[model samples]
Target: MGKTTNALENVFELAYNGKDYAGALGRVKAFHREVAESLAAGAGPYMMADVNEGFRDAFEALEAQLATVSALRDYDEQYDQVVSYGELLASAFVAHVLNDLRPTRWLDCRPLLRTDENWREGLVDWQATEESLRSEVLPRFQEVQTIVTQGFVGGTADGRTTTLGREGSDYTAAILAYCLRAESVTIWKDVAGLLNADPKTFPDTVRYPEISYRETIEMAYYGASVIHPKTLKPLADRNIPLRVKSFLDPAAEGTLIHDCQHPPLAPAFIRKTDQCLLSFSSKDFSFISEENLAVIFGALAQAKLKINVMQNSAISFSVCVDFSERRVHQLLDLLREQFTLHYNTGLTLFTIKNYDAASVARLTEGRRLLLEQRTRGTFQFVCQ
Candidate 1:
């Protein structure tokens, strides 16, 4: 849904900028129908009809909503509402395809995964979610050979749609695995398994046959693209193992992330692009004490700004965070009353885990570093 939403948002942006909404709507309708038809073409007659109806319902809902909109308003709210169609349409089509192979039931996950009112990044009410799953999802699992559900979406208590941030589907899978207490959760990817470096970015990538939960978490925290950062916590909490396997070659043994120590023998690289380095200085040139740090952190929390890396000096504190205009402005508004702020955008954060001197020199060779931090096992740099 995250990727789909991003693609659709480009269309939405065009419409908002005074491009013909009809053209965008037409494209959306055509894309939806095209996907549905392609799926239904291989299905049996009855199954094709069923799939068509499901797709029709999804299309109708989106069309009705889009028909009333002339421009983007309440960006996050509208984004949540509009983008959710992707999951609905996708799951419907997938369920039909799976049913053709075997008995399968389509499950709407909104009712089962209850969350707070946060639009783009909702906080889960775990107790409610667990209870709802136990009561709603468990019984259906017993009746059907397979239950197909959408990821990255949940419903608020007041029945509003909410998303769990971008690339949150992995977290969704982990949530289900944790609540269900499943033996293991396997994430099928294009690559064979977890790699020391992203294959596309760096050549000679080394795949990990096995990794510990702690190492995986560190990799994720350092902005690894292979897995969602939030995914490991729930699975780790329950001691549920996670497997990263290649969809192209399912027979091969993939990377296993379990409780035992199987640390990477080589440095693991992670790169986060399009970051913002926010510098906060005391208004009166006073020293940055613990109280100042607490206030800044509290404001960050209130604005839901995730700090990737931070450094503090006597009077100034600088932090690297993902660049989000709306949220950044919100944070600035909260802090402007007490602090002098400066920010540098279009920065990249690079991290190397289990780093050696050679790997550190290679990673930082040509980059102009804005900030650097090091620990016993890891090195991080904010660079232009």
Candidate 2:
């Protein structure tokens, strides 16, 4: 869930099972009013009245939805409906504020970006989306100097809300840039730039001034938290450069990712926590053959489980994947008919790109290593 959705859920919790919905509703209205007042104080009132009316309508619509929902559960329909308000509220606030400075237009992106019915992690319909953008968004861009729209949210054909995935705002930006044929896409972050390791986790992290798209994609694949994993493909395919800039110090050069060579660099450290290690063996005490591997991989794809690291012997095959109880159970149910399964949860998968012996030792020094795999350029460890 997005930050705004989490906050709204907290508000709902405080409201005592919707008995005090007015309190939460009043808070939202007051916040919108405060933002409008702050913007109106500096600029002349050209569209303030209209923007305020729009905000009121939006809030009322949200309130009506909240009144209808009795409880919050894990169902996809209710989950998507509740969490999508985060982006909507954020875009609305930004649009109203920007309109005060100049003639800016607020665009609801749900109508423009079309996707499948997968509510939580929607699959984009590229043909329908591109057509809608050409017909609907391009004309508005020509008319207005600035347009604000919600990210991470799209609409199905029948007009139901859906989200791309968690932390998908970067993917949303990339999608817009690809459709617009943009010169470049800049993602603003709190850090100075893309660092070799997460500064919060490791000390003395070094920032990369520039990196190639392939290297960036590899880093993202290994669980780099700085950029969303799905964000690099579209930009790379179109040969669009992506700049990671600091929002705090905007003047800094930050890091640029383009189609160019990356100089020899230090080892990059990536850590993915809360992992599960699953091992499979043939029930008849036979070798894990090609056919068995094919069935296992197919089931993994069906369950939407990504294997971060894997190793196989003549009799057993072990793999590390992100831990999700529901999905793990789903995968196990499908595989149990043929293979015996054993799993260990609460593990951490660490990856080092361009690693040396010293760096490898540093990571595994005091940890209980469960699995290890190494290649010419990369090394991975699953540790407890």
Candidate 3:
């Protein structure tokens, strides 16, 4: 997301999970109206949709081509075109607003984060990506500019639509900052900044003025909604600093994430509700060895089942995993031939980062805790 007109410096972007696209789009519209009004004093200057009428033809062509492809990888090009609609919408809207106020640039991010054909989670080939950004991207648009672009999406080597993982727009910003070596990257989120815990859950939560990148990564892993897990890896790899600030109050200095030596904050409580835990064992009491685990895990990977925790013994294997419609059913069908499978759904997974005795109690106090595991900085529990 960026400003509508040539006020080139007001670029606001957000990394959001498409899960809430409806709500997100509403936010986009509101922001566009605000930017439009700020720059031009009236909304008439901005065009609602700058698809240029050619958009329909382009979409139809892409759709026709997509209808013919069977393999998932084969649809990369078409996917890129389809998912990029949102970006085009943003850029188009912004450009329309700027048609009079100022000259604005609508940026396409695919050229910057080019990757191999992994489709949805396109594996970014960093060296090539860096070179492309430095050579083609940075030198051209590095100047102070108001650029409107899409996030959570990218293009592939063969020119296909490849989305970064869900909630990937943040990663997109980091990559952009790293490639351009921007002074800093600020993620304009709806909230004030990173809080010690979710304010809704922990009434006493306080915002951390600043936190190290390592801590942010940990929070992301524990299901902290503030930042996407994928968003941190690239920035951390390059040691680039990141800030999460509220779009409403752009002047307020929000939480800063970088390498620092401050004492780590208290354990952060994170809860992922509505999970499923499965327990399995061979009907004939067959030994569960490396080979058996390998076969099971192979199937799991093929189905894209993300396992959170696992514990196995000679006769039985018990594991905690996320609930995915495809993988869960596939795994059960496969295992039923050799083992008796039982699973419990509608369970809650609570993770306390940097756990202490008090933190553990606070998370599991009244819950029917099922499975608990604690380490120096983290404690995970399966609660019903």
Candidate 4:
């Protein structure tokens, strides 16, 4: 939706950030049909569609499987294989559409972004990615012309397909800007741009037209959905600018994220709902010192448990974390010998970046705050 809007207004290149093969192809296919109809009816400007060939079978199977199981992991691998197909579908369709409008060259992105075989969460071997971009993709894109390519999908070492983490296409755009040294990377979204608060949650929300890279990173860390955490790293590393523009209004200025010294800005609000707060206390009445904490942290790392906040006293320690069933139970069992455990589920953690007294009140006004922490520029509260 965002991409099509921007493309009509002379914003040519687009990078998507989503699973390559997990969504309903029929819905997306239908969406493209609607776009085609709208253009034909003169109600919309001309735009293109890209669909990945890999997703067709997976989408069909997903419909059948939906009747039986709702578990995401049931078809994680298959879903990935299918979701990656969007890149292929999108790039090819865009190439054709643009050519119909005027002469253009479309590029396939698979051979461009080389990565390791971590499957759904494949890590980009930077040297490999850089070499390919410089040698293969960059040279092809030398002249100033519109180029369309898949974003979140890449090729593995053995020539098999792999995908970046879910919603990783944003990272792909940043990487491209870093490698090609583009003027800027713009992420076209459905919304106006980065808002002070989600309009759905807080009415009369304010749009932030400019934000420092550090502030953006902090917001992403606290669960802001506008940008991915990894997306900013490459752009920030190269001092490249990024913009989150509205696909609906391609000509709007949108929000710009760049380097600056932003003095404690607005009370950045974030809510992490559906969480588990876990506490571990020594069973033998031993002090939970640095060594003990270190060991426990290592176990948490091995289990892939992400800790959002932690507090420790002499003999007991507590941490708020996300619930990933695959490893949390195992970690609890392993820690049983050294510590007693307690936890609370169905909790929401609210974080305020660059907080003030009034900002805090506006967020937790009527809600009960169970755990509260205040830092120089941040405040956090856990509530039911």
Point to the candidate with the largest TM-score.
1
Model 2: how far is 69 from its true place, Å?
A: 6.5
1-384, model 2: which lDDT tens digit per residue? 124665665555544354776766576657766765665565555566755676677777777766656556434555566567778877876777776667788888887888898767888888788888778777886778898888888889988888887678888888888887889999999899989999889998999999999899999989998898888999998999999999999999999999998678889999999999999999998999999999999999878788999899998999999998878999999999999999999999999998999999899899989999999999999998
Error of 1 at 115 (Å): 1.0
lDDT of 3 by residue, 96-183 (tens): 5665466566666776678877655777787888888788655545563566666777777766667776567787888777777777
Candidate 1 global CA lDDT score:
0.86
In the range 110-151, model 4's lDDT, one tens digit per residue, is 777888766666688888888878786666655626777777
Regions of model 4 farther than 4 Å from truth: 1-83, 90-92, 103-108, 117-119, 142-144, 262-264
Candidate 1 vs candidate 2, lDDT winner: 1
How are the candidates ranked when ordered by lDDT, highest leading?
1, 2, 4, 3
Reference-based TM-score, model 2: 0.86
How do the predictions measure up, each by TM-score?
0.93, 0.86, 0.79, 0.77
Candidate 1 residue 134 C-alpha distance from true site, Å: 2.0
Candidate 2 regions with alpha-carbon error over 4 angstroms: 5-74
- The top-ranked prediction according to lDDT is 1
Model 1 residue 31 CA deviation (Å) reads 2.3
